[model samples]
Target: MDRDAEKIHHDDSISHSQREASSAASTTVFAADVGDRTTAEGPYPRLQDQKDDVPQQTSAPAPPSDTAPQRGKWQKAIIVVSLCAALFLAALDITIVTTALPTIAADLNSGAGYLWIGSAYLLTSAAFTPSWGKISDIWGRKPIVLLAAAIFFVGSTLAATSVNIAMLVAARAIQGVGGGGLVVLVNICISELVSMRDRGKYLGYVAIVWALASAIGPVLGGVFTARVSWRWCFYINLPITGVVFIVLYFMLHLDNPKTPMWDGLKAVDWLGTIAIVGGTLMLLLGLDLGGVSFSWSSATVVCLIVFGLFSAVLFVLVEWKFTKNPIMPLRIFKHISNSAALGVCFCHGYVFIAGSYYLPLYFQAVLGASPLLSGVYLLPYAVSFSVTSYATGLFIKKTGKYLPTVWFGISVMTLGFGLFIDLPSSPSWPRIVLYQLVAGFGVGQNLNSPLVALQAMVKPPDIATATATFFFTRVLSTSISVVIGGVIFQNEMERRYSYLRASLPEDVARGLTGSSAATSVGILAQLPDDQLQIARNAFYESIRVMWIMYVAFAALGMVISVFIGSHILTKEHTVAKTGLKQERPVAEPTEQERA
Candidate 1:
């Protein structure tokens, strides 16, 4: 009887152990499935090797459970059209001044002030971009967007009536403040209005507006400066802003949080704000002024650059440890995928924006195309980019995949830049157009994917913050790239000055080798055929070096994008609701705060 009892007990024990193992297996499978549906088992398994270090103890603020309220098709169309109009005006302003810079300088009699007109706008725009995102999160998107439009209107009015360079530069600065907000807020609004899975489709519309503006801006600037007045460029915005305002006022309706005025005011990270804004302005000033207004090694340049770096570091420290309502939460970087996406964005901005700026110079100087013709030449690139951007978005929406597009885009971009290195001084139209089309198509594929991937990786509350940060990085990198491109081109020209000047008149050579080398392509038109040939060769070679740099950045972007793990973009949207009495979405307390 004892032996039989022992056997029964052992069997029961074995059965109990088997049950425990089965339960463990079920739990593991459940966890994996949850991850698969949300954040785990990404296409890039390599990134998963390093465990995500997002603080487990401190969770992000829970976003509103309310889904975005659906609207009729016409309502959605109105919202998109209004946002596109706003984007068009802002984008138009960015490039409209490029072709008119010479005339503006000549008219204002401020040769020294020309750079600041553009720089001021860029500085304020980039500096205040992240703030707009945070501010909109608190104050609501509608009010902030309206305020942005108002400021832009005022700035445009002031710019049109400016009697001096100082006034014009300050006006542009005001415009930048509004322009930055307009751009960031529009993006935030889109996030609220659409699911992450469907975002690319609408962003394609935004891309079209930008492309149209870019294609026409320079041509319009040239025509206005030549046939009418450069002031018309500023004047043009007034009507567009009016249209945007009217459309948004009547049709746009978004949820606003019911937080009191004083509470919202207190929630802002004032110190961090000062640090980032001040630092960005100083840094951009140093970059824009370097080699143009001052020697790169001069005291003003060195001090500005150094102080800017220090301030940036200070800003990071403040956000990490000091502010509960941090302007840019450091936790966003805790995810490897986010970091990798940022890297890709950085390179994209560096390569594409700088490429756009320099390509015009190449056409005007090397190929001897007129400013207007150069703008015309740019159409192929702009059109290809716009078309491809829209198509890629549709492709992603249909397939629910972004990594393949991202990888393929960067690969093609690398090849395009590589092809540019072989472009000759007397390249045929087919060669020029075909090369640009290749590069533009590649760039278009990437225009929306990185941002989509970034939004997919973060919590709903972090979406606006992440979007703002992404633009900030892109803007900052663009600033750096334009400066670096200028430096490389100028230095290359200087290196070749002795050889080129040997065949040219002293005055002509001086003008070509001076601060205006890249911009003063008009000088080439005045040169003798032999001197013009020399100048073209020099410009082509210098631009070739720039292409080499772009190729490197494109390759780096591809490599960086490799580690960006893909997440399934959620169809459900859970953005914050405004005008509702709800707790603000601030960073959750640390362990110490909890204690």
Candidate 2:
């Protein structure tokens, strides 16, 4: 009876051990299931990276929720078109305003105060671009972009109703706040919507929008300012902006970013913002009217120079040491590639400012073409830009290398600048078109390549900073370039006009100028033919001097381009916390285990 009882106890022990082994196997399998469930429940992995396979505690703002309304195909298309229109409008404004400068002044009966119509808009737009981008990153791009559109429409409304130059300039500045949002936020949203391989295509689309707008802007401005009224140029934005606002409200629901909104807002470096706005305004003002508004030695000029310099110093200091978040974070220069990229972008922007302003002069002034005709003449430029942008995007996808394409694009631009440098006092229309085509082709290549390169170098942590640096450098350089070009043009024009001060009729020449503000082309257009001839000569020669200065500066961009770091592929950042995280260990149950 004892032996039988022992046998029964041993069999039961063996059965219990077998049960324990099965339980362990089930737990290992179940652990993986729990991990899968956790992953399934998590928010967008797009916005976060886990360290040590543990999820990050903080992340980018959650995008518009899963509960947010959805859109149908037609609705989505309309929203996209609206987005494209808003961007195109912003770009168009930049080019269009220049074409109508003379018309605005003549119609408003304003002096050089009218130059601020364009300069103020530019400064204000560039100043707030980074700010809007950061805000969108926190609050959501849709709201910010919409708000900007509303503001732009209102400002345009005010501009159309303006009774004086001051009002027009003020309205333009207001419009800039909205314009700034559209131009900047559009790019940010596009970055989020596509994969790396496809990103270039979307950016190209933005460029296409810009090109189309840019291509047609002067023509539209010419038609509007000439036939309808200069005021209509401002009014046209209303219906367009309204349609955009409605479309976005419906179809542009994006995933909510995971970054903290409040944190990002608080991170905005206010001091940098203020300094940039102030310094930039002062510099632009000083440039536009330096020779005409106030002599270089006058109190106004000195004040502008001093104020701009001091404000700039303060901005740099604040960004370096004091700000919790710097608008143009000085720390972005920590990477050599970033610094080089900035240099290249800055060169590009500076040259663009000087070129955009002066290139049209050759058409309108030298060729005696109407504003509309001049716009038509500029068509080849947009063509080249569009072609190069599309071609380069394909090259990037296939080759995964941008250096060669970039080099070719920049070289073409440099050659164009060289051609411009050699452009005589009067050149044939073909020469003008040819030179423009060269520059445009080069610029098209550059438009998106450097940015793509910059994005390649940094992780998401630095994306905002890198983005800001890219745009900030461009604008900052532009502001400086405009000022420099202005001062040179002013001095040279004054020197040329000095020939007339003593010889011309006293009535015509009397108080003809006092450095308060020089007579603009519009104001000069009102002068008698003989007097117009004198002013035009000075204007024409002075404008040439500006282009001469851009040649070396624009060419310098290539030097910076050559130094961009080796091509690095973007890959996954966060690791899975659980998985076949490890293989289960098998137990050896002694020599008889297999049985």
Candidate 3:
């Protein structure tokens, strides 16, 4: 062909492909920034010509097409508020029940039952998170989110009415199935609604919900337990979810990729799903049970961990070779920036979550604060976290940069935890408040920035998968952190068992030692001043030892943050076609193409 003829043909192909890009069945074509080397090197590859192993990169996102209307300010606000509410309920359940654990245990005659109550929820929530993210792509985000909320509603109802510890445990597991989805789906929906550049500012709203939930969960749990009934903890979810369901049903509108039911079913990666869920369950179970229900060296723990690792390997292989549509796509991990951001997320989840759990313990054991008062003492952390998270989000939006926030957050977190290691047996209020503020400020910066980084790095087609994978990493890290922190604390307690046994009466000491000792934390309140002092000192020392683990994770995050590559924060709102419904059925392939 002549040069002009070839140019004409190329322009025709570009036009054809750009049209296909808007179809629900194909990826959206993101325009590259001026002078972007990736696109400048060659013509952009058409979807049919692209291979699974290759990932597309573009810094500038094209404006939304005529078909998908841009959301106005109020419309965006309503959608964001609804998502935040859903996230609030899910995060609330994670912490609220902690304050009521002792009451629940006593009422149900459950010894060491508090452990399973929390473990069951975390287990299911973490295990199912990635699945929710992937399936939302196939089924559309709206239906999946609604389904998740409904399941959570049922679980909360069952939990509220449960008469036995076994029933409560089962109920919480069900809630986790939904809670996991809510946590992931809300974030996914938010990503869809805004560009990476503006996402942080909106994510600040999410951070506020999280902070409120974290700050109030314990307080609310205490109030219900002391003033009414602990069951109210579950009851509170009913109203919030109801409002979320109603509001979202009316307001949350997005393109549905009207895939044929049969095709959608076929698109499901069954093998990958089973492998990931099973592996997550087994791994979490092993970690939760090891040293608590059974010795770390027990056959049960060993077998579960081994099988889980094997299954995780199988999951990777299935996604890589077997599945046409993987639940967790391997392409998201192809970039160094994504890998580094995920590493930072893992460390953030590890140190920050475990630190939050232990802080209340310190207040209760060392400071002689009740559960309610402990929650109050944690206000500095919660408030600082909220403030910094919001402020950082605004900063990211205004400046269109995330690396600096990530760097500062992780550094501050490491410094805060380092200070924690040297906390006196009886810390002054100002010292306690200031240290928590430092840590919380750091934690807040991380709340959304790493996710922002991950989203910015991947192509539009991979956004949901990338977001899901990112969350799965963080949630999994949190579960591991808790279990490992528990193991460390339990061992420290064991090392000092002789001291505790000698210092207190035999019966009192017996109740406060061994695996079940944590359930007896309330007993410290009844002890004489001298006995309380001794008990507090033991707890203070044991918990202080746990701070080393936090410091290590924070430092690791700081190091990882340094390696995270930068991506341009584009203003155009773009999303992968995975969730958008097609305007019409996809045309059947010709015989020649099929062959």
Candidate 4:
């Protein structure tokens, strides 16, 4: 009996042990399966894949709960048009206000404060640009763009209603914040939507928007100032921005970025932000004041310059070591091509923007044309820019070569700038028109090439950073160039006015001394014919000096373009639909594998 009881207990223990072993094996298998699934689908499959599974619906696609559907051709066209309009609005604001500045100053009795009207916008725009790029990377493109547009609209409203010069300047600063973001965000969105091979073509269309704005802004401003009110210049943005918001709200769709807002805010490099903003503001202030409001050797100017340099050094250090995410990533400069391309971009801005601002001045102040007619005269440059940009894009798309085009364009641009130096004191209208067309053609050819080449070289994830940095460098260069141009032009005018003092009455000399040195055509028109002719000759000589500077910058750009080495154009998209890895080479299967 005892032996039989022991056997029963052993049998029960064996059965329990078997059950425990089976449960352990099942748990191990289940965990392995979960790991495999996670590895295959990735972290954001739920967010990215939902777009593919979305059912066709009629009512504006339900706000894209997880992911947005791939935009069809019609949708893309609509979105592109909307983006073009948004970009046009921003670009238009830059030049449109220039023609209206005198009106604004006169109305508000701004005096020297009128300088801040344009400088404030440019300063804030350059300072805020990089941060906007970094922020868009964290928060997704759509939200940041929408927010920028809203801010711009509010600024325009405030600017239009501003009762004082101080208020108008402040409002322009607010507008700069939005305008800066709009420029960066538009490039990023296009990079995402179009493949690298096709991106140049689309970007070329965007170039058209810029060209048209450059050409039309002053004309439009003149029309409004002449016929209506200068306030209409600010108010004009209202309808255009409203249309952009409505269209983008409905038509623009992107994957809903899942990062929590609080997390994104924490990740921001606030220290770097402060350093860059302070640095840029100081630098711009120093440039704007030097030889204009203050002598170059003045204590105020010297202090600002020193502070700007020190802050810039601090910004570099912070970006290199301290920040997890940098506003302008140092890693991008790792590629020699990228660095060289950006250098070219900087030089291009110096030539392009300086030319844009000064050419109109020449027509109005030297050639004795009305403000409206001066803008019309710019059509040769503007039309050539638009046509050549589109054509170059097509050329690149077909041949998949941009390096040659870049080289040719920069060289031609240098030649064109040289041609400008030969314009006589009183040149014919056709001569001015022809020279402008030459410069515009050269500019258009390479305007979008650096951006295209940079996009092709880097992986997709860095597109926004790369784009913003390129634009930042360009905008900063433009701001500096404008200030430098202003300094040179002003100094020349002062020297000329001083030389002419012996030939004129004391009151006449004094009249052209302070505020009237940079007087508009309308104001200059009020002068006697003899005085007007003297003013024209002085301006003509000063503008020629400016053209010499343009020629030098353009020549430097040509030299830099030689180093932007050749790269193979890939047919595959840079950023994949999954948004995981950014750099992947196109893989073609071997013929033997087909077997």
How high a TM-score does candidate 2 get? 0.73
Q: Look at candidate 3 and give me any clashing residue pairs.
A: 256-580, 256-581, 257-580, 257-581, 258-581
Instruction: Show model 3 residue runs off by greater than 4 Å.
Output: 1-68, 102-115, 163-166, 226-228, 498-517, 523-531, 579-595
The worst-scoring run of ten residues by lDDT in candidate 4 lies at: 578-587
Model 4 residue 375 CA deviation in Å: 1.7
lDDT of 2 at 174: 92
> Which residue runs does candidate 1 get wrong by more than 4 Å?
1-40, 43-62, 102-111, 226-228, 578-595
Residue-by-residue lDDT tens digits, candidate 3, 1-595: 6999999999999999877766523333322232244334333221121212234555844322223457788987888898998999999998888879989999999997767888888889988888887788788888889999999999999999999999999999999999999999998888888776789998898889988987788778888999999999999999989999999998887656766678877778899999999999999899878877888899999999999999999999998899877888776665556788899999999998866788878888788787667777888888998999999999999998898899999999899889888776885977888888888888899999999988876655566778889889998888889878877877787777788888899787777666655657899988999898888887888888899978988898888887686655766565656543421122232332222
Query: Where does the lowest 10-residue lDDT sum fall in candidate 1?
Result: 47-56
Residue 508 alpha-carbon offset, candidate 2, angstroms: 11
TM-score per candidate = 0.88, 0.73, 0.84, 0.81
Per-residue lDDT over 470-504 for candidate 1, one digit per residue giving the tens place of the 0 to 100 score: 99999998889888888888888878889877998
Model 1 lDDT, residue 219, Cα? 80
lDDT of 4 by residue, 101-186 (tens): 88889999889898788788888888888888777767777888899999999999999999999999999999989998898888
